[model samples]
Target: MTYPRTRGLPTTRRTGQAPRAGTGSGFLFVMATLSCVIALAGTYYFFVRTTTGQYIDESALVEAATLNGPAERASTQFLDWLPVISVVIAAVVVLFVTIMRRRWKAAGIALVACVAANLATQLLKDWFPDRPFRGVQTIELNSLPSGHTTLAASAAAAVFLVVSPRWRPLAGFLGGTFAVAAGVSTLVNQWHRPADVVAAFLVVGAVMLPAGWLVLRTGNRWNVQDGRGDHWASSRLWALLSAMAGIASAAVAVYSLIRIAPGFGQENSTTNYFWAGVSLIVIAGYLATVAATWLFGVSARRRHAL
Candidate 1:
């Protein structure tokens, strides 16, 4: 069945009118500035005071770090490989936005946002330079804003702009999970305090959300087609397949986690197995949903061509 494309209410665009300043770009700029200011202010508060003003604290970090050998190893592995995963996720968002929305502007804006966030984090770190590692007591430089969290949030915003609105909830959930994991890992590893992680989340969110909103608004104005037509069977099938793949990947990841860190739970060996099984099943369902949607789009296109 042919599905009618939904169009938004038309707005006037005069030739002499300055090209509509990208809402996403403008919003990103504002957020980046705000995050930088906050990071700087927090750094000053921690360093400038005569007495050691602990602006951020991570009491739980000590507990998290004292995990059993297996759990500690697992966490280490997760942290070590996190940067690679983040880069891959970012690449996916850029590619999806470029292909689906045909919005080079939005992609560029997202890239800029990522860069700005990273720079801001780095600058803040430099400003609040942590003392050289002198054992557990050594305080590290300004770790107020987490670079990993920033990357995750920016990437998530980019993906949200490219994907259909129906997928927003899933995108947001995945993004939030990544951001939280980044923050938690840093805290547990004693690389950053809890306040730093919290600040990072707030800073990233403040920038990303507005940037995404702008991208959506500007993208709507451009009249770009995402190529995913509403062919019920095809769409459903694609979503199912994509979701299945995602689930499978997630399962593999979880299994690897368990194998690498078997001592995570109590002596009851069955608990780990149970949780792994549950995780696999849940991830599989999510993957299946995504696969079905993607496959359905492919099917629709093929049929249209025929």
Candidate 2:
């Protein structure tokens, strides 16, 4: 079965050379991955090793505890089944797409990245030392790079990489929402701090970005995209919506932190930092989705791809 090649990407003119798509994307992927790793280390250093960082992080979790009501129970229930939920949904969708599109190699690539991301998270958790007693009575269980969040984010990422550009916008949106919701749930249930979720997002991005570069290279024949307006799922509107949401959430995070800064050490938090942490997660997850979507869309175009 010959895969339909789109007239989207350019081939070598009269040279009979194979099209080189997104070589620049490869470099960008490396930079993005390095950035993620550095950010993870930074997040750990500040949130787990510093007094103020621990205090603020712990403060958010503490404030979250004060909201003792149905939300707590709901988050608990959601987290309890998150592992299974992530596996089943990701497996079903990815498997269906793989079989339908016959994207065996692409599926294999995505699977490796997914497994690698999750495995890296676990290794980091074990390798990292316990949180130091930073003047705060914090739990020193090495729970950085939360496993639940890694699972959810990687699962969503795998689906995002598997689908064609035609379906990416919708897939990215839904997948991002799932990841953000999962992260917020962990915080609500007090299972992991905000930094843990953020770290998980970074890990997934680090792994998935390289895998996406490979997908574009190996599956260039099928990765063709006309334009953002070509399909509803491929619309820039989806990206705009995600960006708008990200910007709004970022503002909320900044505002929350600013409001709590003047009296940070002295005053006990009244759900300020908690919302801030949640805001950070939302922005990170949503913005990453938007970035990845834009990268693929641009890379598939003439300037980046051959």
Candidate 3:
């Protein structure tokens, strides 16, 4: 079956030369992946290895546990199943898109990204040295990038990548929300800290951005879809909402951090840091989603131009 190509991408004008759809997208993907790697390393250094970061992370864990009760217990019961649910949903979505659109290349790219992201998470967890006894009584082994968060984020990202551009903004918004929730739930359960979740977001982005560009580079025709005023999922409203939510969360986190700065190490209350960490996770997740959606959209347009 011949896959319908998007008219937006340009082919050879007269000489019938092979398409160069990958040119601009290839550069963008490289830059984006490098940026994510830098972000991940920086997060590991500042949050996982440093004294201040450990204090804050430990404090948040304490606060999160304290905040955990009947409501939290109920939440964990459901959250524990998120990885399985995410995998199932992502598998169904990826298979459907691959079969319906006959986008075998896209399917393979998504699968590779998912596996690479998760594998990277586990490797980082084991390879990174334990944190020095930073005056904080906590486990020494580094848990900077969380496994569960990676699972959720990568799965959600795979689905986002497989879907047509028209559906991405909505998928990004909803998928970001799900991933963030799963990250935050880990916090509530005292399984991982906020920075861990944030790092997970970066890892998934690092892996997915390149994979997404590959899809655009290979499946350009099927990847590009009419997004303007098409469906609710394709609307700009979702993008706007995601941006608003990210901005708001960042502002709140800054304010919380400022308030806690005065008593940074001496404070007994975990409330401020807990919320602040959660805010950072929210900001990272939504912003990454928005960036991914925008990258694919721009890459598609540029491919058409080439």
The runs of at least 3 residues in candidate 1 whose Cα sits more than 4 Å from the true structure, single-residue gaps closed, are 1-58, 129-140, 221-306
List, in order, the clash count of every candidate structure: 32, 1, 2
Top-lDDT structure, candidate number: 2
What ranking of all candidate models by TM-score puts the best one first?
2, 3, 1
lDDT (10s digit) by residue, model 2, range 1-306? 333333644344444344565655677777887988899889999999999889878888888888789999999999999999999988998899899989988899999999999999999999999999979988988899989999999999999988987888888988998999999999999988999999999989988998988888777666756444667778778888889989999898877877777665424459888998899889989988998888777776642234
Which 10 consecutive residues of model 1 have the lowest summed lDDT? 9-18
lDDT of 1: 0.50
Positional deviation of residue 98's Cα in model 2 after best superposition, in angstroms: 1.2
Quote the lDDT for 35 in model 3.
96
TM-score of 2: 0.91
Residue-level lDDT for 69 in candidate 1 = 75
Model 3 ranges with Cα > 4 A deviation: 1-20, 225-230, 263-268
Please, what are the lDDT tens digits per residue for candidate 3 over residues 28-99?
Answer: 789889999999999888877789878888888888877847858966886779878888989999999999
- Per-model C-alpha lDDT, please? 0.50, 0.85, 0.82
- lDDT (C-alpha) at residue 240 in model 3: 87
